[model samples]
Target: MKRRPRRSVPALLTALVLLATCVLLAVSAIQLILGERPWISYDTVAATLHDLRWTDVLPAVAGGVLALAGLVLLLAAVLPGAATVLPVDGSFHSGVARGSYRSTLQAAAAGVDGVSGARVKLRSRRLKVRVDTTRTRPDGLADAVRAAVTDRLDRIGPATRPAVAVRVRDPRRTS
Candidate 1:
């Protein structure tokens, strides 16, 4: 099952700004109708607009800022977000959370002999397993970890099997 990310934050902010503008305009209109002074001076705004020119530095900077903000909002609305869950391979429809999948692979790698610690990173189509060992010479540790992780992946049966890469690090070596 595919899930789309929510774009509520941008939408909510845009709505709030529009609402505030509308409320301000309505209040100003009511004050004018009652023959009371409005919060903003209309004459001053009209004079400023009349004096303003397209080539003015202030107007150019303001226009650029507004265009940049619009471009950002447009991109946020159009771009697709990363998947939160990975699909599992099976006759019945099922999926697995990325955290759970990574943990399972890490456990498999850590269970191997001579491995002091294991860290697994799950990418779109890559599984990187970093193994730490106390043994000074970790000759075949990387291969062992790779095989174990691959076996676990097979059992889990993800829809897309990522390529497994194992790296063995010796704690005693500074380099």
Candidate 2:
């Protein structure tokens, strides 16, 4: 099942600002209709706008803040978040959580001879496995870990095969 997208911070902030403005305007209009004068005179607002120059610091600061806010919103809208579940195949008819993939890779690497433990990080384009081995020679352990991981990846048959990277570390060195 697909999860709902989380609300973006910029979008939320803009909504709040707009809501507050609407409330204030409504209150002011109500007061004006009852014959009460608005707190800030229209003349004052008109004078401020009239006096605002292109080189003024207030205008520049406001423009910069608005531009930055727009940029952040644009980025948040465009960049997709990490998927909670990955498609077993390109068709996405069946899928599994990302944690399951990591566990599968870790189990495969740990099953390799000389590997005492394994940590796996799976990204969109890369599968990084760090293996702690009992063997003194890192070379043999590294090769074995790579082959086991490669076989596991082939079995999964993801839409794109992530490049497998194996790093072997001595088990004793961590202690």
Who wins the lDDT comparison?
1
- Segments in model 2 whose C-alpha atoms lie over 4 Å from true places: 1-10, 16-51, 90-92, 171-175
CA lDDT scores, all candidates in order: 0.89, 0.82
User: Per-residue lDDT for 93-157 in model 2, tens only?
Assistant: 77667888889989999999888889998887998999887776577778888899899888988
Give the count of colliding residue pairs in each prediction: 0, 0
**Candidate 1 lDDT, tens digit per residue, 27-140?**
998999999999877898899989999989989999999899899889889997656677888888888887898999999999999999999988888989999999989999
lDDT of 1 at 49: 87
**TM accuracy, model 2:** 0.67
RMSD values, in order shown: 3.0, 4.3
What TM-score does each of the candidates earn? 0.77, 0.67
Cα RMSD, model 1: 3.0
Best by TM-score: 1
